[model samples]
Target chain A: MLDLSRVQKELVDCNRDKSSGVSIDLVGDQLSHLAGTISGPIGTPYEGGVFRIDIRLPDGYPFEPPKMQFVTKVWHPNISSQNGAICLDILKDQWSPALTLKTALLSLQALLSAPEPDDPQDAVVAQQYLRDYPTFLGTARYWTEAFARRVSIGTEEKVQKLVEMGFPEALVRTTLENAGGDENMALEKLCSG
Target chain B: MGWIKVITKESLLVAQREDLRNIMDLLEVSEKHARTLLIHHRWDADSLLAVFLEKERDRLFSEAGVTIAEPNVLAPLQSSQVTCNICNEDVSADAVTTMDCGHGFCNNCWTEHFIVKINDGQSRRIRCMFYKCNTICDEAIVRNLVSAKHPDLAERFDRFLLESYIEDNHKVKWCPSVPHCGNAIRVDGDGYCEVECSCGLQFCFSCSAEAHSPCSCLMWELWVKKCRDESETVNWITVNTKPCPRCLKPVEKNGGCNHVRCICGQDFCWLCGCAADQHHARSSCGSYKEEREKKTGQAKRDLFRYMHYYNRYKAHTDSLKLESKLKKAIQDMETISDSKEFSIKDFSWLTNGLYRLFRSRRVLSYSYPFAFYMFGDDLFKDEMTPEERELKQHLFEDLQQQLGANVEKLSHFIEESFDEFLQVDRIMGIRMQVINLSALIDNLCKKMYEFIENDLLGRLERVTHNIAPYESKGVERASELSDSWDSDDSLSMKTCNVDSYLQWDSSANGAGSSESGSPTDDSFDQSSSLDESGCSSRKRAKKEALDDPPFNLNLPAEGFDKN
Candidate 1:
């Protein structure tokens, strides 16, 4: 059993701390699956970008560490750019049951400011970070701008596009919102329905 | 000689308790605290005490996460509700438990934490749940709280704690028995020694491989892998078979003709291994080629070299297998001699000589592979000059040849039908020869081991190889640790003292050399008694053998002479 009460309590506790700039929200109806977003630390290449993380609480949650990975691809040494995987000791054998989702997210946020090149999830990025610092910083900043800085795709444009595909304007708007403001995805969902 | 003690499932608790008691007594701590210290230091009490001497007492205790709570402290008030930091839930005092480290968590949270750590296989050391608190949670509290929800997992926790003595301790190892005998062996001295388990399997304690004394553990490991790999067979296959030009399947040349036809209906020139293409009928492809000759020549040389060593190794192993059957024949001969009209009843020398033959034959078989590695370019190529290697090779081979010849002669003499000899003088002549050959073979084996140790391996600096010293009494059978835990305490105290064990070891070594004279007559008496008393005496004899001094080789010849 997942100890749903503790996870529920953790959610309430994390949300109460709005100043921490790290928050976890349920991804869907499932409490075990969550989405965590953290603002990159100030004065770093990742600043001004919101890094989305996919969080999964295994059944032995809190006792076993929660599995967290980068969802919004950010170029970093200790995180895989190809597939958003993290290399953090807290996520592995060093995980203590006392740690929670908020602390883990903070750790991941802290990792953005200081990447561990020696123990790397992305070998290419680690090599780049080790051999050429300026190039690595520029590439990382570019990746943040391209992928992580959420381009609020014009919601009005998606609503219009889905509505023109012959769905109700209200349904199109909800579907577009559900599809994260993607016009084509909202249209596909409308047509499939 | 280092003493190796076999610890059966029945004795594991006894073996571990002794160490725990020593730590408990020395440290003036509870059993749980002692166990924590012992488990941390890998059950080496001396090292744990050394750490105590080197560091402050409080530092040592705190470093291992041991916090001994002061006695006579009042319990926390039972009336108030407390909040568990883990779940952040307010619960009544009775619903929460406080560990000795003073970290309190609700029972529900504690059970959950214990379950998680146990499932993660970290049962031996489940720390208190407070962040940055390193104190290990008391085992009793974990057990009491866990068994409430899950009895089986609590049992698993106990098992894990019990098995840590073997799993963590370097001196102790589980017998590498398949279908596991549930027995572990502990060596009191040097780790590199041979021990026979109570399960009747003798293995090198260091590598857990079969007892191969003259061959170092590395050499034995390589020899076993090489034999299992059948590299020589593969070599022969590569030498004889050529791939078909069309299908690429391996095709063997069954005849002397250069034109060969594959089963796939492809014709190829055997010399060039090329598809026929109008060149097959002319036999022009048979012309000498340097490349082909060189490749085949190298393969031929490698195959011959492998065959030379493999044949000798296989020959002795086969002889050993065949000679094992001689045990039954010798037992039958003993029965015949017992019932004969003649007064000669004792045939202990025959049985003793037969055992010597078996032991020597095994040594002789393994010696071939040992020689293969010792003299070949594979291991010691740069260690010795070619001339030095040749000199050492001759010295080793001479001993090997002498041992091999004497072993064969001992085997032959032991197999003779001496009970059929009506003349007492003829039987005596056979007995003298068997005894003399047994002694000679034992001496030759010891000499060969000495040569291998001092002459061959001793000179090498880049590599260090150690063989289990030759034991004339055969691989030492590890005696069972006394099942009583109290005796183990004294035994461990003696082992820890070091000087006493050294004196005992030296004295035992002296006794061992003298006892290497002959197999004791008691074994013959026990076997004879078995025949007279049916199956019961055999069981008693086996029990007696386990308890008896392993080597009692100095039986008087007059006992056999009178018989």
Candidate 2:
């Protein structure tokens, strides 16, 4: 069984510090599924971007490392451009029970700043990072601008769009709130329920 | 003779005790620390000793996570409470367990960590839960904590640690028996030899395939693959069939003209295998191209050369299979001679000659594949000039033919129905011939191996191939390890689960009795061919022993015929 009390404590502890530049929120009511967001480190190609990561805690949570992968597309050598598989050692065999979701997100932010091209998840990006440095930087910057920028649309605008799709305004508001501000997850909830 | 020992599940700890004791005594460490070092070095004591001599004691101990120094003492606690970073909860001092690394965690969290790592198959080195702390958590702690919660998983962890002697070592390999005999064979000397497992399966120690010597392991692997591929039949199919352009499946023309239609509804010209339309079918597609035939000249010769050796190899193997039936008939003749009024009650000459025939015949059959690679352009083309290759081929073939002819003579004499002979002198003459023939065949087999090992393979450059040296007897039977290691009280208790051992003990006993006992004394004397059918069953029957009272596990290997 997952240590639900520890996970609850972790959530309370991680969210208490706003300056950590990493925050995790439950994707659903279940403690097993979560979403984490980390600000890209400043003075890198990924600066000014907020990268969303999909986190799933296995039953052996805290004992086994939580499974984290990039949901926001970013062009980096160590993070897969195609599927967002990470090649970070801490996420794998080096994972210790002491590590939390917040630490993992911070590690990802560090991976963005210092991409290890030699041990890469994306071979093409790694090759470009090695052979053609300027192009790799350009591609990474363009991808951050294209994908990792937070959707700036207002909640009113989201309500208007769903209202335009023939759902009642009050129901859309509750569903959007229930989906934790994720428009797609809210839309899925709206359609299914 | 190779010093090979058979290690069953029951004898696994006894097999591992030797090395573990050496490391424990040499390093003067506890069993857990010794195990950590041995597992780190993959149970190689000599290499561990080398590292011990070269490196400082602190470095060696720290590298393998064996903590000998006293852990740093902390300041006296204001209260009997401390916080475990993993759970981030305040706990009483009694609830916390500190490792040698001086890092402490709540007992609950530590137990959970051990369970997770053990379940993940990382039991061999479950390091401290603290991040970046490479100190391996003591095995006693792991066992004590894990057994408190999950006894079964702790047993699994124990088995994995015990099995590391075989699982992690290159010198030992589990016998590849179907439905698994639960046995491992440990070869002490060079691994480039063949061994007959106590379960009666004979295999090359290097590749673990059926014993195929004279042919190098590489050559034997290729020959088995080629034979399985049925490359000759495949070549014939390639010559006869054309792939359909639509489906790309090979389509043979059973009886048709130059145009052929596949089941997939694609029509193609048989001459060029190009898709055929109505207009192309009416016209002559093309003339039979002479250049295509010229291009396949080298491949054609290679195919013929392969067929030449393959045919002879198949012929000898086929004779070997048929001669096995002759073994039964000879045994019947022995029975008949026993009841008759003949003075000769001993049939040792007939059985000995038969055993010699089987051994030499195998040497002859495998020699074909050996020659196929030795002289062929594929393996050793540049190793010898054409003239040198020709001269060497003749020299090798001369020895092969001499061995082959003598083996046939021995087979012929063994098959004689001398029991029907009323004249006592007639039986005596045949006995003499059989005895002489057996020794001659044994000598010829020895010479063939010597010539191949010393003259042919020894002289080759740019490639090294070592065949298993010939034994005057057949493949060496791996001996059962004695029960002396039972004195290692530290392991014998936890090495195996008593219930599971009993389950196996009963199952093995059942396999033994149903197959009939005394398989060695009767069938083995007449023919070695009975080994496959009789030997394993009899070995299991003897293994039905070890009825030592309650987990002493003092099972000694039995039923070895010294002769």
Candidate 3:
């Protein structure tokens, strides 16, 4: 009845693409609410480990940006660790009807890789973020492994990674999403776009 | 696609050099259009638009909407009242908007709130007017609500509202302000403090000054309006301008020209309100003698009317200074007499009353010469080091300025820090004989009741810094390093990072240097409104001192403190 499917498809697509290596894991079902995994983007502290992400789409479809929360603990300027609520303009005050869930995930992946240190949602993280971007990356990657790597059977590893090199599963999922969900496509997307 | 002589697409593509560059400037053209154009015509970024222009005759001009010829399109109505969400301004009915929640507000106010994210081009997520539900509005309601009311502004501001456009943080981008420069700057929106144009132009968003334009939205509106009006006038006059009748050279006049007579024996007529032809109108009806007499008579009556407001502004400035002096003296007395000392309290009250009385007089003082002094309240508490309090006295002055200068130099400095701040303070101190020269100026201004408090004490405040020990004063030494952050999550909140925020690392005019200085440092002293007051309170304290002083004490009446 609603355009939820279209918006979800876009989220699925965006989750697969991005400069930040992205990975998505469907813990439960894909049509309703879903949990995804992403590896740490390269050069970021979240490089090695896996990170979990949750996407909750409303019935209104593309008109509303989906509510996404980081299931894994990772340091970021906009994301609050207390609940992993993000402070990106596109997701909150700037939610556009034109945006789909896929775009939101890709944006989140981008936010993870290159965070803003000026208008920080997290004051502490922002301080460290402005003072040292590299160090923030270190802890972010470390946390990704500590939390996101937990996977069992029947769980589809739909994660995407975009940025190559040191970027782990988080980027892998992002890459996968950007590449239209094909591993080779992911590599090609990374090399090209 | 070329409308000219028949030319193959291959030949045209080979001839053009910038086919690829033009796509970047197409603000309205979709990215898909660029891809299609590139594929079909093989046009590069520079010439894709050219190819489009070859098809859509008025393409680029139509996109930018450069046509605003009708100035009288809307007649100026009288006393129109439209409720605004922020204020009850009287705007036109067409400017009013009623939200779905039944809130009525003018478009101007909504736009002001909506422009919270300037770079992202997103409208501010305004809170509901209803007191009960203070929820931040989503774009859906704003679109539906504003459209039903003022469809024009809603449409105009809608593009500015990015709430849903760019989901998930794509990199922050900016409108390239340079000529022919269209690359969106992938900048961090957190600091959003500075914008470095691709042309290597740097500007501050805080002052609206070059390199860093930082005025608020209203000031920006005024400045932009002025620039636009000027540019429009320039462009219009340049296009259809009449020549200086005699010289036959095109002329553009900024000022009112009632008698724009040519060098030739021709008189221009102001009464007609239009340009005159070869046969010009006669001047003054040959009654120049009578008109001169009449104007001479009017001058006398207008002088008093003119002085009335001027005098009022003068009185207002004087009272402001007296209040500042009294307030400062009282604050110092109170701090020293924390245990409630009688002499300190008595002095504070005495100065307060004297300051108030002077404030009430609101008269022009022509006879009394003024003076200022910031000597250590050496007479006050013995336990607290006079040096610290006295140097801290300079702190009160420096708190107001980021890069302090002489008391006279005070008039010159407004926000721009020296090459270095601390050393400048020390170097500037050496120039002055006083230990706390900056404070000495403030004290001197207070003691002498000098006029131009902004010029004097205001400049001394530049070198002042809000300092806290890197490590806590207590045993924990816990940096709470996180405490300095604006939020636990934003990660981009850039406040409290002193090293990154406060620069001017160069030797501040040899400030700290023991040699080559003046006597202003003798009175150097300091306050920090509670740590919670923020840098703004300091700015306010300085501005308020000028606006709300208790007396018109113009010290150094005859250039005594002149730099």
TM-scores of all models? 0.81, 0.78, 0.25
* Per-candidate total of colliding backbone pairs: 2, 0, 194
Model 3's TM-score against the true structure: 0.25
> What residue runs in model 2 are displaced by over 4 Å at the alpha carbon?
A150-153, A158-193, B69-79, B231-303, B325-341, B417-419, B483-563
Strongest candidate by DockQ: 2
- Shift in Å, residue A115, candidate 1: 2.4
Q: Which stretches of candidate 3 lie over 4 Å from their true place?
A: A11-36, A42-44, A56-65, A87-89, A92-99, A115-119, A126-138, A152-193, B1-563
lDDT of 3 by residue, B1-563 (tens): 01111112222222222233355355344332332234333223335456455656234323322122234433443446654423424567777654433444566445434433322343433443333332344455456555665676576545443211212113323323556333232222232244433233434333323321112223334434544565465446545554453444444444585556655544454443234654445633334443222222343343333343334434544744644454555445444545553332222223323332332222112101010122222112342355654564465434323222333243222112121233545434332322233333434333322322332223334332111111001101001112233442222112122231122112122333343234222111101221133433333333233323223223233323432
- What is the C-alpha lDDT profile of model 1 across B57-103, one tens digit per residue? 89889888898875533277566888777777889988888777777
Task: List DockQ, one per candidate, in order.
Answer: 0.51, 0.60, 0.01
Stretches of model 1 off by over 4 angstroms after superposition: A150-193, B70-74, B77-79, B231-296, B332-342, B417-422, B483-551, B554-563
